[model samples]
Target: MNWNSPIPLQAQTLNSLPSIMESHEPLLSLKQYSPEIEVYPAYYREGLSGAIDDCLLRHGVAQRLKKAAELLPAGIRLVLLDGYRPIAVQQALYDRQRNHLLEQGWTESEEMYAELHRFVARPTVDPAKPPRHFTGGAVDLTLTGPNGWLNMGTPFDDFSERAATRYYEQKSDLQPDEQLIRDHRRLLYHVMNQVGFTNYSDEWWHFDFGNQAWAILTGNERACYGGVVPQASN
Candidate 1:
């Protein structure tokens, strides 16, 4: 089967979109939501600063995630990696990625920032333009089967071109492994999209709902969810 790519969201697009009315949806804990959801907090596991051990998302986003999990093929479980990141965690991730890029020979200039922004959003405190994870409406996830995590071409947080959602689909004469990767990516993308989540084109495991990115990609006039910090009760 053939798959089309989603348009990547730009800072300009997110900045221009206004939230007609802000949503005050409480963040819900994914760990308490379902057994099928494997809430593995990636940043926390890596010991990133301010990272929470449990995954959380906006109330509505959690509902959609449950629906998406139910829609996945039998024996496949959704692995929720990261969600509702604090500014500290976001800053840690951004700084780490920037340093990695620099070590990879990326110069400190507009060109490096353009590439860095593809995988990590610059840390921000502005409510109108919060980082994706800061809104509690974006999620990083992949699929795991009876055997284990399905190969989705690239691992979560992979900042290479192969990490693109449709990378394998765009290639020709794929090897068996590559073909499996493509199928897995397609399944993950379609299942989440079917439940109203918008997949981030730069990363197969990333998806958004009710946030600025989602609103921009889905043509919604206003974003419902904005930057929000998750409470302990969440």
Candidate 2:
């Protein structure tokens, strides 16, 4: 259930769509999800959420985020970094990076695109679909305590092996700071799991709810949210 991409989609095995999310549910501002949880939009200075120009996600997603925030220890809060990426935004990012890679001598082939796809989804519209962020179901977030942001080892969107949710677990290092990072990752993981989310095991900051990844990890027979469809948060 952990990879650069979602799980259910990762497996060639597919599921039928659930009627509930055949279309996107209303998009809800992260602020409306809970004032206790902080919203830090990474891409939008003038996107959705008008005044703050933050991001939006399905209303069902907001409900789960509220539940997850409630489980945090006193003084610790959830800080969402990115959400509801416009497909145009996604394409711009993908094109920039892919062009950089190509400049470095990477070839244009399925092999190359697959490697690129691991981190950035191709911006084209196809029956296969786009990245989770485009669907408003995926989010990049971290924990912030009274002191400051907990050390997650790397910043959000690191796109490296060090960013792996279980990266520290795979090492034999006895460094105290290393252990601290591992513990922080687990705290976020456990709380999100409690609220029915599935982590992108490869990226500690990425988590999905009501998407194909959620269905595969939670064993739901069908996925709800498919693409960039989100209704207002009720």
Candidate 3:
């Protein structure tokens, strides 16, 4: 989505965006990286059939996941939901969400669309500038351990405050069962951060390694990923 929307970045990440945008890294697919890290390409492939090829990512993104997978506590596997989305797919998702918002009569306005994109990126047509997913450095995923799906409270695209990473962090007016959800979220937070990836505060299942968001977040001078076409650009 939008690189600097809801997720507040550290000072380092904030300073790296300009440089990160200048880099031209190549894209790499996760298909052959490691069998332990399972992938579900085009989980929301509703309107995008011939448009997408596979759930590819930057070589560095795959490498980070490889290391993150290895560091996962016993009886756990990193579950990749979707990766390497084309701008067409990004536009479709944004439009779909925006339409749903409008249908619900949520005050249609240009500002409303920006608000709508707080959860999803507005697809920028400029190939030189791509949304986080288009860069192939971002991924939507969740954790699965021996106990089964590590519930992070709300499901993967639940556009609500309950989806925030810090939502469960605070102990305000919480139910007894919610603590477990909070704990699981905390675990993922720690594990992912330890591996050098940044989480979009709005979406618990979403994480980026070296995209513009990641660069801005982690303070890297330049991002390691660029827009990824299904084949060449990364």
Which candidate's lDDT is highest?
1
| Cα distance off (Å), candidate 1, residue 178 | 0.7
lDDT tens readout by residue for model 3, 107-150? 87888887797888878745545689988889888888777778
Better structure of 1 and 3 per TM-score: 1
Ranking by TM-score: 1, 3, 2
Report residue 21 deviation for candidate 2 (angstroms): 4.8
TM per candidate comes to 0.91, 0.82, 0.83
For residues 47-163, what per-residue lDDT tens digits would candidate 2 score against the true structure? 423223675877888888889898878998899887777767887768867887798799999887886777777775442455677777888899999899999999887767898
True-structure lDDT of candidate 2 = 0.74
Rate residue 38 of model 2 by lDDT. 90
Candidate 2, residue 43: how far the Cα is off, in Å: 1.7
lDDT of each: 0.85, 0.74, 0.73
Cα misplacement distance, residue 10 of candidate 1 (Å): 13
How does model 3 fare in lDDT? Answer: 0.73
The clash number for model 3 is 5
